[model samples]
Target: DQVMIISESDVKSLLTLQDAIHLTEKAYSELNAAQSMIFPAVREEIKEYQGIFGIKSSYLIAKKYIGLKAGGFWLGNAAKGKMNHQSTMMLFDAESGEPLCALSANYLTAVRTGAAGAVAAKSLARKDSKIIGIIGAGTQARTQLEGLLATFPVEQVLIYGKTEGKEELLAKEIIEKGYSAAICPSPQELAGQSDIIVTTTPSYAPVLHTSWVKDGAHINAIGSDTRGKRELVIDRKPDKMVCDLWVQSSIMGEFQHGITREELYAEIGEIVNNNKKGRENEGEITLFDSTGLSVQDLEVASFVYEAFKSKFV
Candidate 1:
C-alpha cells in the first residue's frame, strides 16, 4: 500500500546522462526484440496558455517495469520563474500492477531525450565527426549538446537561435565548460560548418534547409514533436531516415511534415537490433527523426526506481 516517493534531487543524484543513455539505448534494442511495449502518445495543445499536455506510457517485459510520464510544456512558465517543460513519472510492477515509485521527472525527461539523440548519432553519424551545430538555445539545446559531447569527440559547438543573445549566452556557457563554441549568425552557417546538426527548437516553420547541409553530415531532428512543430525543410530526403519510433514519428514528429512512411529507412530500434543497416558510407547524408518515446521514459524510470530501492529500502 506504500509507494516510494523520489524527488528531483534524488533522481538527479541517482541517474547520470550516461546512465540514461545506456538505459535508453537498451530500451531501443529491447523494443526491436519485441521485449517492450510503447502505447501511443497522447498530446494536445492548451490554447488558453499556449501550452501542451501529454502522457507517455510503456511496459518493459523483461525488466518488469510499467510506467507513464504525465505533464507537458508551458510557454508562460519562464515568466513565472519555472521550467517551460515539467513532468512527473510513476512506476508500477508489471506483474502485479502495483504502484512502486513516483519521481519528479523534469531531469529525467531532459537526459533521456538527450540520450535518444546521442544514441542515434552513435549509430548513424560518422566516427570522425567533430563539430556539432545546435539550433536552439533552450534547456533541450544544452542537454542535446551534453549528449553529443558524451558520445563524440566534438572539437567545436555552434549555436543558432532566433532569440537575440540566447545563442550567445549558450555559446558562452559552452566555452565556460571548457568546450570550444561559437554563435553562428544563421542556421545555414551553422549547418555548413558542422559535421552533425541537431535541431531542438519549437519552431512551426523550418529553420534549416537541404541546400545548407553538406554530404556525410548527420542530422538529429528532435525539436518538432507536436502536430504543428517543424525544424527542417525536407526539400530532399536524406540517404537514411531513422526514427526512434515509427508509429509516433510518422504521425506528429518532424519527418511527419512532408516525409512519408515509405521514405523512412528504419526505426532506430531496428538498427540497434542489427536488423537494419546504419550509415553505410561516409559520403551519405543521414537523419534521425526523433519524436521521443514512452519506452525511453519507462526504461530510465525503472532504473531510478531500482537505484532508490537498493539505497533506502
Candidate 2:
C-alpha cells in the first residue's frame, strides 16, 4: 500500500539516454504489436498563464503496467527560474488497481522524446548521415542531439533558434562533447547542411519549409503535439512519412496540418516490427512526426520505478 516516490534527482541518476532509447523502442514495438493501449491524450491551454496542460495515459497488457503523466508548458516558468516544461507520472498496479509509484517526469520527457526521434531516425535516415541540424535549442533539442549521437556517427551539428544566445550555448556544449557545432542563421540553412534534422520548437506556425530540406535528409518533427502547434511546412509529400502513433499524430502532430493518413508510410513501431518498410533508398526524404506517446512515459517510468526499488527498497 506504500506508493514509491521518485524525485527528479532519482530519475536523472537512474535513467540514461541509452536506456531511454531502448525503452522507447520497446514501448513502440509493444504498442505496434497490440500489447499496449494508449488512451486519448488531453491537452488544454491555460490562457491566463499562457501555458498548456496535458495528460497522457496507457496500459501495457504484456508487462502489466498502467500509468498517466500530467504536465505541460508554463511559459512564465523561465522567468521564475524553472523549466518551461513540467510534468509528473503516476504508476499503478493494473491487476489490483492500486497506485504503485509517483515519478518526476521533466527529464524523463526529454530523453524519451529524443529516444523516439532517434528510433525513427535509426530506421529511416541513411546509414551515412553525419551532419545533424537542430531547430530549437531547448532541453528537448539537446536531448534529441544526444540521442542522435548515440545512434549515428555524427560529425557535425548545426543549430538554429529564434533566441539569440541559447543556440550559441547549445553549440558550445556540443563542441565540448567532442563534436563540431555551429549556429545557423536560419532553419533553411540548417536544413540544407544537415543530413538528419530535428525540429523541437513550440511554434504555432511552420518553422521549416519543404523546399529547404535536401534530398536524403531525415527530419524528426517532435514539437507539435498540440492541436494548433506546427513546425514543418511540407508542400510536397515526403518520400516517406513515419510517426509514433497514427491515431494521435494524425490529429495533433506535424502531419495534422496537411498530410493525411494515406500519405503516411507507416508508424515507427510498424517499421520496427518489420510489418512495413523504412527508408528504401539514400536519396529519399524521410520525416518522422512525433506527438509523443503515453506508452513511452509508462515504460520509462516503470523502468525508473523498478531500478529505484532494486537499489533502495
Candidate 3:
C-alpha cells in the first residue's frame, strides 16, 4: 500500500477557508439527503465504536461533517484495532480504490468548523452586524474569528477567556491582524456589546444568559460538543434555533441540556441550501447550536487531500 504521508504544513497550504466553505456547503446538502437513510442504517455500527478512545472522543469531530468526504470505515478488532480514517475522497477517479491523496485531519477540522460558523453567521446574523464577541482563546476561537471576518465585514471584536493572559494574547494577535480587538471583563459584557456572539469554551454551566443578549443578535454556540458541555442557559428561546446536525445536537451538546428538540427551527444545511428561512425579522434572536459533525471532517479532509494532490504531485 502506497500510504502517501501528508504533513500539517502540506494540509495548510492545500486548503483555504474559502475553498473549505464552498465544499462544506456541498457536503451539507449531501448529508441532509443521506441523513435519513444513511445515518440511521449506519448509526448503530458507528456507535459500536463509541468511546473507543480515538474514534469518537479524541480523533474525529466537526460541526458539519460529510462522512464520505473526510471519514472512512475503520475495520479492526478491539484487541488489535487499527483505525482507518479516510479522506480517500476519490471523486477524481471511479475505478481505483486508490486514494487520490491524503489530508491532515487536524487542519481540515478547524477549517470546516470555522466555515460552518461563517455559514450560520451569513444566514442568521443581522445584515449590518459589525461587532463580534468570542469566548475562548484557543485554535477554534481563532478560526471562528477568521471565518467570521472572511464572511462578514466585522469592524470590532471582543474576546474573553478563563485566563486573562491568553485572552490578552489573543486580543493582541487579532489587533495585529487589523481587526479592532479588546479583552472583555466578562461574558455578560461581551454579550451586551457584540452583534454576533460565538462561545467556544468547553464548559458545562452556562457562561451566557438570555438576559445578557440584546435584541437582533446572533449567537453561535460552538463549544458544546459533548453531553455535559454547554455554554448558554435556555431561559428564553431564540427567534430561530439552527444546528449543524439535528440528531447530534438533540442528544449531546447545547441542545441536549436545555432546549427541546421541537424548538429547533432549522439545521444550518437547510438554511445554507435555502431550503428554509433564516433571521426572519429585526429584533429577533438567532442561535446556532453546533454539536460538530463527522461530515465536516470528511468534507474538509477531502478538499485538502485533493488540493495537495493538484499542487504537490
Candidate 4:
C-alpha cells in the first residue's frame, strides 16, 4: 500500500475556506441521497492530560472510499507553542480495504465545522440577513465568519469573547478586511444586534439566552459537540431546529439531552437535497446543531487526493 503523505501546509494551501464550504455541501447532499455512511465518533475526556481525544470515521459509496480522522484537543498546548486541535486522516479503498493516503486534518476540521454553520445559515436564515454575531474568538471563529461572508452579503458584525484583547484583535482583523465589525460587551449584546448568530465557545452551560435574540434570528450552535455542553439556552424548544445528523445531534450535539424528535425540523442533508423544508416563515427563529460529520472529512480527503495525484504523482 503506497500511503501518500499530505502535510499540514499542503492542506492549508489546497483547501480554501470556499473549497471547504462547497465540498462539505456535496458531502451532505450525497449523504441525504443515502450514498454515504457516518460511523459513531469515539470521544473521551482525559482529566490528567487536560484534554479531549476522539476518532471519527466514514464511508462514501459514491466515491468508493473509506477513512478515519483521529486527533485531540489539548488545553495546555498553547503554552508549548502548539495549537489546541490536531488531527490526522487515513483513507482506504472501499473494495480492497487498502490504505491509500494519509492527511493532516486540523484545517479540515475547522473549515468543515465552519462550512457546516454557513450552510445552515444559507438554508435557514433570512435571505436578506446582513448582520452576523460571533460568540467565540478562537481559530474556528475566523473560518466561521469567512464561510458566512462567502455565502451572504453581510453588512455588519458583532463578536463576544472572554478576553478583551483577543476579541478586539478579531474585530480589528475584520475591520481591516473592510467589514464593519465590533466587539460586544457580552453575548446578550451580540445576540440582540445580529440577524444571524454563530456560537463557537466551549462552554458547558448555556452562554446565550433566547430573550436577547430578536425575531427571525438564525442560530448556528457550533461549540457544544458533546453531551452536557451547550452554547444557547433553549428554555423551550426552538421554533425550528436542524442538525447535520439527528442521531448524533440528539445524543452528543448542542441539543444533548433536550429536544425531541417532534421538535427537530430536519437533518441538514434533507434540507440541502430539498427533501424537507428549511425555514417555513420569516418570523420563526431557527437553530442548527452542527456536530461535525465524519463524512465531511472523508469527502475533503478524497477531493484533495485527486488534486494531489494530478499535481504531484
lDDT of 3 at 138: 69
Write model 2 residue lDDT over 96-214, tens digit each, in one string.
88999999999999999989988899999998899999999998998899899998999999999998889999999999999999999888889888999999998998999867989
Better of 1 and 2 by TM-score: 2
**Per-prediction tally of clashes:** 0, 0, 11, 0
Relative to the true structure, how large is the alpha-carbon lDDT of every model?
A: 0.89, 0.91, 0.72, 0.86
lDDT of 3: 0.72
Please give the lDDT score at residue 145 for candidate 2: 92
TM-score per candidate, in order? 0.97, 0.98, 0.81, 0.96
- Per-residue error for 297 in candidate 1, Å, reads 0.5
Candidate closer to the true structure by lDDT (higher is better), 1 or 3: 1
Compose the digit string of candidate 1's lDDT tens values, residues 1-313: 7788999999999999999889988989999898999887799889899899999899999988889999988888877989899899899989999999899999999999999999999989998999999999998998899999988889899988987878889989999988999888889999998899999988888999866889999999998888888888877668998988877887778877767889889999899888998899998999998888888999898888889989988
| Superposition TM-score, candidate 3 onto the true structure | 0.81
- Candidate number with the higher TM-score (1 or 3): 1
TM-score order of candidates, top first: 2, 1, 4, 3
Pick out the ten consecutive residues of candidate 2 with the lowest summed lDDT.
255-264
Error of 3 at 7 (Å): 1.3
Residue 256's lDDT within candidate 1 is 74
Q: Count backbone clashes in candidate 4.
A: 0
Q: Which stretches of candidate 3 lie over 4 Å from their true place?
A: 35-102
